[model samples]
Target chain A: MKPKSFAYVRPDSVEEAVDLLAQHGEDARIIAGGQSLMAMLNLRLVEPSILVDISQLKELSEIGVRDGAVEVGASVTQARLLAWPELKARAPFIALALPWVGHFQTRNRGTVCGSIAHADPSSELPLSLRLLGGEVVLRSKKGSRKVKAEAFQQGLLTTARRPDELITAVRFPVGVGAEGAGFREVARRHGDFAIVAVGAVKVAGSIRVAVGGVADRPGLLELPAGGSEAERRQAIEDFAWELGGYDDIHASARYRRDLVRRLAPIIISEAA
Target chain B: MRRIERDEIVSVSFELNGKRAAGTAQPRTLLSDFLRQTLGATGTHVGCEHGVCGCCTVMIDGVACRSCLTLAVQVEGRRVETVESLAGDEDRLNALQRAFNKHHALQCGFCTPGILMSFTDYLGRNPKPSEDEVREVLGGHICRCTGYAGLVAAVLDAAREMRGETEPEGEPHAA
Candidate 1:
């Protein structure tokens, strides 16, 4: 399972990194923390002609909070986010979900923006981004654009980011009174990729729920304006039906729908 | 910021077992292979050659990470502590290793190095971890021999030894 031969480069600045990516386009792949990319590389699942290692870019490693928004840089590791007290104070749900992202070791090097960039269907980072109302900043030599989490994640293992674009950072608006938030996922093992995961938080005054691994991308369901607990749960069940699921070796579409139907209310209630 | 051509060999220098170790590896070579084949530090075994197995766990710059997932060239100027560093100059077993023997924490012995390295790193920060905390740390690893009962005991025992506690009693899983 050795990887194919590939050229390697480490750009010192974000601009230079983007320039290199623009020069290579689809032939180049960016490696930030190298947690997920290295595994894929070892398995030969992806073979880029040029490998751009961005782990050394100092500009992308700093975590900043401005205008009441937490901006996680592309090189910010998952462990680094968990270490920041502001993250827990600003968004408790993200803090709760970080521990489940991976094991202690992988978290030490796995980047939050890298997880978002990878766009795994069952990942907790993407679900947290969507439920908390986050934005992904994509940059290229052409210019830059901010895409919401809902739109940035295009499909399973796919994103709205172009080949030449570099995800400079991702910003999640601080939770206003985001207390009592909760996250849970059912995985075969603690560190294994989740079969189905749910993330919920109190945004403004309403409880927003996002379900992962049930469809091509994590979906944010619209709750009724006002209803009893049972009625809201029924709406969630119906919403689960609208989310498209497919049969795979891990779970059947029907089973996944049931999981969403059962998991949504529990997590939403916990967030309350 | 050095750029290399395709399949170019690069020299990687890192602190291994508190000493400088230098070797040459292609960009694709994993740190686990570099330690075993290049440096002859086979104590870091590769069970799955993937991140899940945890058999290749080591201390990189004081943080425990799976060597298989880390590229060899990535360890440039980094400090690495393998299982070989656990023993003293006289080759005496460390407290954790001694506890594992007393508690029957290992049978196949393939998963011991990773578990020891992981617990060694964990116990350093948390000298007195509770059972649930230990289990949470252990959850990151997989052992097919069903030796968890003994493994958990070894961790708690090692923690007690580190904390300088009195004669310790093993948990229900203790051998």
Candidate 2:
């Protein structure tokens, strides 16, 4: 399971990295902690001519609040984000979902922006970002642009990210007053990819529910909080049907829908 | 930035188990392969090189990580610890290893190295972890023998022993 031959470079700055991307275009691939990309490379799923390593770029490793949103740099590892003191107070749902991203071993080397850039349909970070309406910061040699999470993640293993663009950072809105967050996923194993994952956010008498692993991408639904239990279940059921779960080796479409219908309400209650 | 060509073999240097180690690697050489094939530290076994199986786990800068998921060039100038570093004073097992022996945590022994390295890093960070937390960390590894109960017990026992909550039980060499 060896990766195909590829040249490797480590850029000192984000600008240099973007320039490398622009120069190499689709021939070069950006690697952060490489928790996901390395596996893909080993599986021969991708055969990039060159790899740009960004893990050592100090400027791309900061996790701080900027303009009322938590800006996580491209090099910020999942373990570092989980250890961030402001995480629980800022984006609690992300904090809850981070533990389920991968095993402790992978989390030690996986980058937050890398996961979002990978755009795995069943990944927790993208699901949380979508539910929270986060922003993805993409930078090319020409300039930088911010795309909303929903637009950034286009489909399964696909994204709005261009071949010549580098994801410099991601911005997640800070949780404001009286917000509640909860996350739960049913995986065959604890560290494995989720068969069905659900995240819920309660804010200002409204619940935003996000479901992953059942659709082409993580899907989000917003519902008023005044509904009765039966009504809430019906709304969740409707959302599940809307997702149109597909059959895979790990789980069937019916099982995934059943899980969403069953777990969404419990997650909502947990958030409440 | 210096770019190493795909076919070029570059000299890579790093601290392996607290000592300077050097090797040659191509850009695509996995750290697991480098450690075992190039450096000849075969204690870091390779299984399911796609990072699902935890057999290739090792410590990079004191954090547990999948070596299969890491490039050999990435460890340049970084500190890496493998299963070979666990013993001290004439190959005497460490506390965690001793605990595993006491709990009969291995039958095939292929997964033990990775499990040992993982818990070694884990116990250092969480010296007083609960049983559930231990199980959660154990969830990272895939073991076919002993059904993880013995592994879980060993981790908890090792944690207790490391925390000085209990004395070493029986003979140190007993199985």
Candidate 3:
């Protein structure tokens, strides 16, 4: 399948990019790496009249610590982030999961912020951001606003970002003292989308388990750290039931729930 | 922000296989089609335009990426290396290609170009990759024939040859 022909523009600055967005509104789409957006376009799933390319914006390519988190800009590709020397110290879970985002080929061209912008329910970046308490920085001609990952991701393939907004960056908070995080997923193949993915982070005697690929959106559940093995298993099982997995071609509702029940504890225990 | 109209044809210029190349394309033309249809470099095959099949893989600025997922204009002024770049000195097969021939890595030869391009990039960065690491990278491609056993052997063999190590006993020399 070929994409429907569309106008293309490469803006030199973030302001110009947002200006283009405000000018075109719903008719224009912002493209960073064009890894996911181009695939959607090739499938003809999206037919915007124009595409604003922002991969060349130098202002949006920073990967430095800001406030208390590592702010990844829109132009920071997945391969770039993984190559950052401080990635393991700043965000170990992301480092562990980045290799699973795609193959070496796609990761070279896929941006970390682009994945958050896409907000796929089964994607590793979204689930990791949600569990680690991150924020998405959105900009437009009007102004800028920061939305937490929980509120930013509305539902399946939907986000709180407006048509005129450009996701300039996403902030993943730096790991605090002695905080341990772990991520695991079961997919049909290593590089394929996960059938069920689980992530866990332990801090100050509490553990948070996040589940993806089994719900309309990635979701998180919290439980105390010192519970008995059986108690922890029961709590995870109840949380799995609450998620209410549905049948799909890849996995059944019951099977997804079972994976959650099985995977949550292992991840939590590993994090602990 | 100057926009190219949907129907406007623009000259997309890039360095292909160590030479300057230029082609005209619409804004939506994929790099794979631009290379094949416009530049006549058909070694880069397109199996699935959506980036899953990994058949359209090529190198941009020394990194492997799916040309089908990249627009022709996006690679403007960039250096692109397709399967055509692998051969050397009167079109002799490269070390990886020789290993693949020794190991019988391909039965249909459709996915070989992408796989060879990937290995070229991979071996440059990691000259001593383990078998599992080779398989991990090879997993990105989907090959129906040869069952991947030969592919794994070829990659490991190629890695040894690139590392300048002597061949083991009774191992056939990769031409």
Candidate 4:
């Protein structure tokens, strides 16, 4: 099946891409790998008048350690991220969930920033990022700004990004002391979107668990460091109640809440 | 009558099967359609249009990708090789292909091209991958007929052959 007709423009630099997006406003879409956007276009879920192909922009395809953190360019593919030695060491959570992103073929073309920008509630990257307190760098013709992962995603498939903005990079802070991370998701089949996914990171004296696919956006719960078993159990119940899962076609809200209550403690215990 | 000004279809020149070729296509046309319809290379099949069914797999810049989902124009100036290009004119199958044939790994042959391309790329990268590693990488390809036992043996056999081991005699077939 052919996609709807749309104008295509390949910009040499991110500045040019941002300008094109600004010119087209909401009618323009920035495409890095075209992994998610192409599928959306084929499904007619979105009809952008112009597709700004930024895949050739080498500046946005880098992975480097800087400022006591690791900054991954928006165009970095999931496959590349999985193979990145530095990222595997610096952010083990990203590594733990990288295999679950998609099949190797899909990961070959899917970009990290594209996944984050899509903000699928069931996606692994967003949930992991939120749990690790990652930040997204948004670029526009006017300037650039950063947003915490927690605040970046407003709802399912919804983000704080504007029509004229492009996600240039995602930064993960260093020094998560004594941190152990775990990512687990239940899906009907391997490589399928998760029915419910959980990413938990335990650092120093605190624990953070981010639940996805059961809520509109990734829901994060913070447990005090070195809590008693009773306190931890109470926190788990309170977090489950706070989630207020939505009933969807995949699973009922009640089932999701129950799973969260059941799985959160296990993940927390493992991390702890 | 209003006339529709045809947008210019960009000419994309790339190396396919070690030969330089060029074609003009719409910006959004997928690589699978370009290969099958435009270039008349039907060896690559499309199973699930989504990326799941690896039937449309092809080597783009030495990496396997689902041609059904990859835009053809994206491969401009890049080298692409399909399953048809795996062997020379002698009709001799590559190690992986020969292993697939000897092990009777394929039932309907619908998923052979993708499986071949993926395994070929895998062996190129890791000639000595463990059994679990093979499963980890090839888990993306689905074969309903063979139940993946024959496919796994084929990969392991190919790995052994690449390591200069002669083909084992009367290899165990899928039970």
Pairs of residues at least 3 apart in sequence or in different chains that clash in candidate 4 = A205-A225
Global lDDT of each candidate? 0.85, 0.92, 0.89, 0.82
lDDT of 4 at B106: 94
Residue pair clashes in candidate 3: none
Of the two candidates 2 and 4, the one with more favorable lDDT, higher being better, is 2
Ranking by DockQ: 2, 3, 1, 4
What's candidate 4's i-RMS value? 6.6
- Writing each residue's lDDT as its tens digit, candidate 2 over B64-139 gives 9999999999999999999999999588888899999988999999999999999999999999888888888888
In terms of TM-score, how similar is model 4 to the real structure? 0.93
lDDT of 4 by residue, B1-175 (tens): 1111125477777999898878887777789989998888899998876677788899998988888767777788999999989865876677777788877889999998998998788788888999887876677787888988888998998889889887555533332
After TM-score superposition, the amount by which residue A234's alpha carbon in candidate 3 deviates from its true location, in angstroms, is 2.0
Superposed on all Cα atoms, model 2 deviates from the true structure by an RMSD in Å of 1.2
DockQ of each: 0.67, 0.89, 0.80, 0.34
Once all C-alphas are superposed, what RMSD does model 3 give against the true structure?
1.8
* Candidate 3, A1-272: lDDT as tens digits: 99999999998899999988899999998899888899999999999999999998899999999999999999999999999999999888888788888788888889999988888889999998898889999999999999999999998889999999999999998973238878899998787889999998887888988899988889989888788988888888889988898899999999999999888878887889
Model with the higher lDDT, candidate 1 or 4: 1
Docking class of 4: acceptable
In terms of lDDT, the best-performing candidate is 2
Best by DockQ: 2
Per-model TM-score on C-alpha atoms:
0.95, 0.98, 0.97, 0.93
